[model samples]
Target: MSQYGAKYKYGKASPSDGFDCSGLIFWAYGKHGITVPRHTAAQSKAGKWVAARNARQGDIVVFRIGRRLHTGLVADKGRFLHAPSSGGYVRMESLSGVYWKNKIVGYRRIV
Candidate 1:
Protein backbone atom coordinates (compact mmCIF):
# COMPACT_ATOMS: atom_id res chain seq x y z
CA MET A 1 0.00 0.00 0.00
CA SER A 2 1.14 3.52 -0.63
CA GLN A 3 2.17 5.02 2.70
CA TYR A 4 -0.04 8.06 2.13
CA GLY A 5 -3.15 5.93 1.74
CA ALA A 6 -3.03 4.54 5.25
CA LYS A 7 -3.71 7.98 6.71
CA TYR A 8 -5.93 10.92 5.93
CA LYS A 9 -4.37 13.17 3.32
CA TYR A 10 -5.21 16.60 4.56
CA GLY A 11 -7.47 18.96 6.54
CA LYS A 12 -7.12 16.95 9.69
CA ALA A 13 -7.70 18.44 13.09
CA SER A 14 -5.60 15.92 14.94
CA PRO A 15 -2.77 13.60 14.10
CA SER A 16 -4.90 10.52 14.67
CA ASP A 17 -7.82 11.58 12.50
CA GLY A 18 -5.93 13.07 9.60
CA PHE A 19 -2.32 13.22 8.58
CA ASP A 20 -0.37 16.26 7.52
CA CYS A 21 2.94 15.05 6.19
CA SER A 22 5.02 13.35 8.82
CA GLY A 23 1.85 11.87 10.27
CA LEU A 24 1.44 9.93 7.06
CA ILE A 25 4.96 8.58 7.39
CA PHE A 26 4.38 7.64 11.01
CA TRP A 27 1.15 5.87 10.17
CA ALA A 28 2.57 4.05 7.18
CA TYR A 29 5.59 2.77 9.06
CA GLY A 30 3.30 1.63 11.82
CA LYS A 31 1.28 -0.35 9.31
CA HIS A 32 4.42 -2.20 8.25
CA GLY A 33 4.95 -3.02 11.93
CA ILE A 34 7.68 -0.41 12.34
CA THR A 35 7.49 2.76 14.42
CA VAL A 36 8.70 6.24 13.47
CA PRO A 37 8.71 9.63 15.13
CA ARG A 38 5.61 11.87 14.84
CA HIS A 39 6.75 15.39 14.12
CA THR A 40 8.25 16.42 10.77
CA ALA A 41 11.20 18.28 12.22
CA ALA A 42 12.07 15.47 14.56
CA GLN A 43 11.59 12.93 11.85
CA SER A 44 13.95 14.90 9.57
CA LYS A 45 16.68 14.52 12.12
CA ALA A 46 16.14 10.79 12.27
CA GLY A 47 17.17 9.69 8.81
CA LYS A 48 20.24 10.09 6.65
CA TRP A 49 19.77 11.98 3.40
CA VAL A 50 20.48 10.11 0.23
CA ALA A 51 21.03 11.67 -3.16
CA ALA A 52 17.98 11.72 -5.39
CA ARG A 53 19.92 9.76 -7.96
CA ASN A 54 20.06 6.88 -5.50
CA ALA A 55 16.65 7.26 -3.84
CA ARG A 56 14.64 4.13 -3.29
CA GLN A 57 11.19 3.13 -2.17
CA GLY A 58 10.41 4.01 1.45
CA ASP A 59 13.07 6.69 1.49
CA ILE A 60 11.92 9.96 3.04
CA VAL A 61 11.67 13.13 0.92
CA VAL A 62 11.63 16.28 2.96
CA PHE A 63 10.38 19.67 1.81
CA ARG A 64 10.54 23.17 3.18
CA ILE A 65 6.98 23.94 2.22
CA GLY A 66 6.73 26.89 4.50
CA ARG A 67 7.64 27.59 8.06
CA ARG A 68 7.51 23.89 8.75
CA LEU A 69 8.90 20.80 7.10
CA HIS A 70 6.72 18.74 4.82
CA THR A 71 7.60 15.15 3.97
CA GLY A 72 6.72 12.27 1.70
CA LEU A 73 7.79 8.76 0.85
CA VAL A 74 9.63 8.01 -2.36
CA ALA A 75 7.60 6.36 -5.06
CA ASP A 76 8.86 5.13 -8.40
CA LYS A 77 10.02 7.38 -11.23
CA GLY A 78 10.63 10.54 -9.30
CA ARG A 79 7.24 10.45 -7.65
CA PHE A 80 6.56 10.66 -3.93
CA LEU A 81 3.79 9.56 -1.59
CA HIS A 82 2.43 12.34 0.55
CA ALA A 83 -0.50 14.02 2.29
CA PRO A 84 -0.72 17.45 0.66
CA SER A 85 -2.80 19.81 2.77
CA SER A 86 -6.31 20.80 3.84
CA GLY A 87 -8.80 19.07 1.53
CA GLY A 88 -6.09 17.09 -0.18
CA TYR A 89 -6.12 13.33 0.01
CA VAL A 90 -3.25 10.96 0.16
CA ARG A 91 -1.70 10.96 -3.30
CA MET A 92 1.40 10.37 -5.33
CA GLU A 93 2.89 13.65 -6.45
CA SER A 94 5.53 14.21 -9.03
CA LEU A 95 8.91 15.17 -7.63
CA SER A 96 9.23 17.65 -10.45
CA GLY A 97 5.96 19.41 -9.77
CA VAL A 98 6.28 23.08 -8.87
CA TYR A 99 5.19 22.53 -5.30
CA TRP A 100 7.74 19.82 -4.75
CA LYS A 101 10.50 21.25 -6.86
CA ASN A 102 10.49 24.58 -5.12
CA LYS A 103 10.29 23.33 -1.56
CA ILE A 104 12.25 20.13 -1.53
CA VAL A 105 14.72 20.22 1.30
CA GLY A 106 16.36 16.83 1.14
CA TYR A 107 15.92 13.07 0.93
CA ARG A 108 16.56 10.53 3.66
CA ARG A 109 16.47 6.76 3.86
CA ILE A 110 15.63 4.80 7.00
CA VAL A 111 15.94 1.10 6.78
Candidate 2:
Protein backbone atom coordinates (compact mmCIF):
# COMPACT_ATOMS: atom_id res chain seq x y z
CA MET A 1 0.00 0.00 0.00
CA SER A 2 1.12 3.61 -0.51
CA GLN A 3 2.16 5.73 2.46
CA TYR A 4 -0.69 6.79 4.74
CA GLY A 5 -1.04 10.25 3.24
CA ALA A 6 0.44 9.46 -0.15
CA LYS A 7 -3.02 9.60 -1.55
CA TYR A 8 -3.29 13.27 -0.56
CA LYS A 9 0.00 13.96 -2.33
CA TYR A 10 -0.05 13.69 -6.08
CA GLY A 11 3.28 12.24 -7.19
CA LYS A 12 2.07 10.72 -10.43
CA ALA A 13 -0.12 13.72 -11.03
CA SER A 14 -0.05 17.28 -9.73
CA PRO A 15 -1.78 18.99 -6.81
CA SER A 16 -3.50 21.50 -9.10
CA ASP A 17 -3.97 18.72 -11.63
CA GLY A 18 -7.53 18.07 -12.60
CA PHE A 19 -8.74 14.55 -12.00
CA ASP A 20 -12.11 13.13 -11.21
CA CYS A 21 -12.51 10.10 -8.94
CA SER A 22 -11.89 7.57 -11.69
CA GLY A 23 -9.03 9.61 -13.08
CA LEU A 24 -7.09 9.14 -9.85
CA ILE A 25 -7.63 5.39 -9.87
CA PHE A 26 -6.61 5.14 -13.52
CA TRP A 27 -3.47 7.15 -12.91
CA ALA A 28 -2.38 5.54 -9.63
CA TYR A 29 -2.73 2.00 -10.94
CA GLY A 30 -0.99 3.03 -14.13
CA LYS A 31 1.98 4.29 -12.11
CA HIS A 32 2.16 0.80 -10.62
CA GLY A 33 2.15 -0.68 -14.17
CA ILE A 34 -1.51 -1.51 -14.21
CA THR A 35 -3.58 -0.28 -17.14
CA VAL A 36 -7.14 0.48 -16.14
CA PRO A 37 -10.08 1.89 -18.01
CA ARG A 38 -10.72 5.64 -17.90
CA HIS A 39 -14.24 5.64 -16.53
CA THR A 40 -16.04 4.13 -13.56
CA ALA A 41 -18.50 1.99 -15.49
CA ALA A 42 -15.83 0.78 -17.86
CA GLN A 43 -13.35 0.20 -15.06
CA SER A 44 -15.95 -1.77 -13.19
CA LYS A 45 -16.40 -3.97 -16.24
CA ALA A 46 -12.64 -4.40 -16.73
CA GLY A 47 -11.94 -6.32 -13.55
CA LYS A 48 -13.28 -9.52 -12.05
CA TRP A 49 -16.00 -8.68 -9.60
CA VAL A 50 -15.13 -9.63 -6.03
CA ALA A 51 -17.19 -9.67 -2.89
CA ALA A 52 -16.45 -6.87 -0.45
CA ARG A 53 -15.57 -9.54 2.13
CA ASN A 54 -12.70 -10.66 -0.11
CA ALA A 55 -11.39 -7.21 -1.00
CA ARG A 56 -7.66 -6.67 -0.57
CA GLN A 57 -4.99 -4.11 -1.36
CA GLY A 58 -5.18 -2.65 -4.88
CA ASP A 59 -8.69 -3.86 -5.42
CA ILE A 60 -11.07 -1.66 -7.43
CA VAL A 61 -14.04 -0.53 -5.37
CA VAL A 62 -17.22 0.48 -7.13
CA PHE A 63 -19.95 2.73 -5.81
CA ARG A 64 -23.41 3.48 -7.09
CA ILE A 65 -24.41 7.04 -6.28
CA GLY A 66 -27.66 8.17 -7.78
CA ARG A 67 -27.51 7.37 -11.51
CA ARG A 68 -23.77 7.74 -11.60
CA LEU A 69 -21.21 5.10 -10.69
CA HIS A 70 -17.93 5.88 -8.96
CA THR A 71 -14.70 3.90 -8.72
CA GLY A 72 -11.63 4.03 -6.48
CA LEU A 73 -8.65 1.91 -5.38
CA VAL A 74 -8.50 0.04 -2.12
CA ALA A 75 -5.84 1.26 0.29
CA ASP A 76 -5.88 -1.00 3.37
CA LYS A 77 -8.04 -1.91 6.29
CA GLY A 78 -11.31 -0.10 5.65
CA ARG A 79 -9.67 2.81 3.86
CA PHE A 80 -9.78 3.56 0.14
CA LEU A 81 -7.99 5.98 -2.19
CA HIS A 82 -9.99 8.28 -4.40
CA ALA A 83 -10.10 11.74 -5.93
CA PRO A 84 -13.24 13.23 -4.52
CA SER A 85 -14.89 16.06 -6.44
CA SER A 86 -15.27 18.21 -3.35
CA GLY A 87 -11.74 17.58 -2.16
CA GLY A 88 -10.23 18.05 -5.65
CA TYR A 89 -7.26 15.90 -4.57
CA VAL A 90 -6.60 12.23 -4.23
CA ARG A 91 -7.00 11.12 -0.63
CA MET A 92 -7.58 8.12 1.59
CA GLU A 93 -11.12 7.76 2.92
CA SER A 94 -12.91 5.26 5.05
CA LEU A 95 -15.04 2.63 3.40
CA SER A 96 -17.47 2.78 6.29
CA GLY A 97 -17.83 6.53 5.90
CA VAL A 98 -21.44 7.45 5.39
CA TYR A 99 -20.83 8.73 1.86
CA TRP A 100 -19.17 5.53 0.69
CA LYS A 101 -21.05 3.12 2.87
CA ASN A 102 -24.26 4.26 1.33
CA LYS A 103 -23.04 4.13 -2.24
CA ILE A 104 -20.93 0.99 -2.22
CA VAL A 105 -22.13 -1.18 -5.03
CA GLY A 106 -19.37 -3.79 -5.03
CA TYR A 107 -15.64 -4.39 -5.43
CA ARG A 108 -13.52 -5.56 -8.36
CA ARG A 109 -10.03 -7.01 -8.29
CA ILE A 110 -8.02 -6.41 -11.45
CA VAL A 111 -4.74 -7.75 -10.15
Give the number of the best model, judged by lDDT: 1
> Model 2, residue 83: displacement in angstroms?
0.5
Winning model by TM-score: 1
Candidate 1: deviation at residue 56, Å?
A: 0.8
- Model 1 lDDT tens row, 26-81: 87777779777888888787767788899898988888865988888887868988
Identify the runs in model 2 with alpha carbons over 4 angstroms from their true place.
1-16
Candidate 1 residues lying further than 4 Å off, grouped into runs, are 2-16
lDDT of each: 0.77, 0.75
* Per-residue accuracy of model 2 over 1-111 as CA lDDT, tens digit each: 343233343323433454577767777778889988877789888879888889998898888888988778888879998776554556788999987898998898888
TM-score of 2: 0.80
Error of 1 at 101 (Å): 0.9
Error of 2 at 28 (Å): 1.3
lDDT score for residue 66 of model 1 = 59
- Report the CA-based lDDT of candidate 2 relative to the real structure: 0.75
